[model samples]
Target: MIISRISRFISNFDNLLALFAGACAVLAVLFVLFLPLPYSEDQLYPKEIDESSPLYPYERGGTPFERADIHVQYPENSPFAGYVTAYLTPFSLALSRLTPHAGTTIVAHPGGILDEILYNTRGLDTVVETTILFIAFAIGSYLFRKGS
Candidate 1:
């Protein structure tokens, strides 16, 4: 039937699918490695965080994720800064599911290469994004092999 023909036609493109998926995965990782996520101070830390109080997950150096700095803040001077940030770090558009700050907006800063490298070093965002992309690659490979 037509459905069977369509299925076979799709299966024949498995290799192409795999290649495209792999390339996308690599690009996603690169973006994460070279993008600085924009976050507010409250989003980066707990609302009641006390750096000098020595409280767990609240004090300075207590959180596992990186802190928000001026670089990560949305530029007030530019009206299109938010749009640019969201566009550059599209992966962060996902709903905030990480710990410490659940109700926070996550976007990437349009920073230089060095800024990207330094900002991503201490956060779990890059790791999470990379993992998701890796999973996508694995699934694509599996499908490709299954069709072969």
Candidate 2:
């Protein structure tokens, strides 16, 4: 009886949070649609990503997705699967160039970026994110269980 009451409280809280989120979404849409705001205009017509920005070398004729100056030589039998995988997910190559060459070590490095992403982030950000996901999944499973 106590367990059932506790579950009911938690389930009610979860439902309230969901409804609050939905209401916020609707409010945001209505606000954007009805109100006249300066910054919101940018959302409607975004500034064209400045091609001539020194970060991305500008070319008169260049591939839409690719930069001009930075030449990417595709490696044979790379960590990536093949040509299609490499093209679809160019992150491997991009990370190589973008990542800092030095000052990355904290005395003892644990493997690669995967470990860093899994472990290191802004303090409790990962913990909070994981908690939220876990709660959501638990609530969803409880609500969508086989019999009831």
Candidate 3:
């Protein structure tokens, strides 16, 4: 009788683990599907400059077009800036999808603040996805073990 009880206990444990694993797999798939793609209008494309255009000289700062210069300025405290920073990681990952040099730059000069944001955001997303998948798998493993 003692031996039978021990066997039953072991079986129960196995069922729990299986349920957890299944749950994790399901959640991982769902997250991958629902996760949003990151992007920004300003950073989406390279700024265009025409040699004959008056704004051409001001592309890198020294120009009569003050607003154009200011547009590229990084405002770390701004809400938009925060969003940009938060999504930097995702953006970088997205970039990598297109090319090999996605997250290669440690501190993208002049774009440091934005780059930091992107890196941090990507890190956060990875963590969250990992956690969700882990939990889902745990639950699925548990259920499977019990059913077995």
Candidate 4:
């Protein structure tokens, strides 16, 4: 009877883990569709391009500045959100490279944070990767339950 109770508890714990993965997958998808990651960018050609400005090089007709399209930021009030975005960063970066103009690029340049979260989410690549991982984890969980 003790062995049976222990096995049952383990099974329930496994189920909970699967549920958590599923929830995370759904959250990632929803974030891609609705959650707005923040970003800040200046116009390429401002009326007055200062010597210290990034566009200064381009203003002189020198080699074009090489940089990502966008730089994203997390809310200062919430560190968890930042971690999630960081986790998605790898997949988003790879996708950005595969499609240069896909509009999900992130740069490390320093920029002021805006009080808006109405921009684009990380990227669909993050959703795809998370979903795939969730599916694989669910399948593995099922197999483990079946085997035991």
* TM-score on alpha carbons, each prediction: 0.24, 0.25, 0.25, 0.22
Question: Mind giving the per-residue lDDT tens digits that candidate 4 earns over 1-148?
Answer: 9999767866887677877888999999998998686654554222333455333321222211232222334434432222222232455445435654433233221111111112123345566778899999999999999967
Candidate whose TM-score is highest:
2
Clashing pairs in 4: none
Candidate 2 regions off by >4 Å? 1-91, 94-123, 146-148
Q: Rate the local accuracy (lDDT) of all candidates.
A: 0.44, 0.41, 0.47, 0.43
By TM-score, the candidates rank as: 2, 3, 1, 4
Compute the lDDT of residue 89 as modeled in candidate 3: 41
Q: Which candidate ranks first by lDDT, i.e. highest?
A: 3
The total number of steric clashes, by the backbone 3 Å criterion, in model 3 comes to 29
- Candidate 1 C-alpha lDDT tens digits along 44-136: 212344333312222222122333232333345433322221232333323333333422233223322223333443346777878899999
Alpha-carbon shift of residue 43 in model 2 (angstroms): 23
Q: For model 2, what is the alpha-carbon lDDT of residue 54?
A: 24
Q: In candidate 1, which residue ranges exceed 4 Å CA deviation?
A: 1-118
Residue pairs with clashing backbones, model 2: none
Model 2, global lDDT: 0.41
**What are the clashing pairs of model 1?**
38-107
Lowest summed-lDDT stretch of 10 residues in model 3?
61-70
Residues 17-58 of candidate 2: C-alpha lDDT, one tens digit per residue: 877888999999999899885563424112233344322221
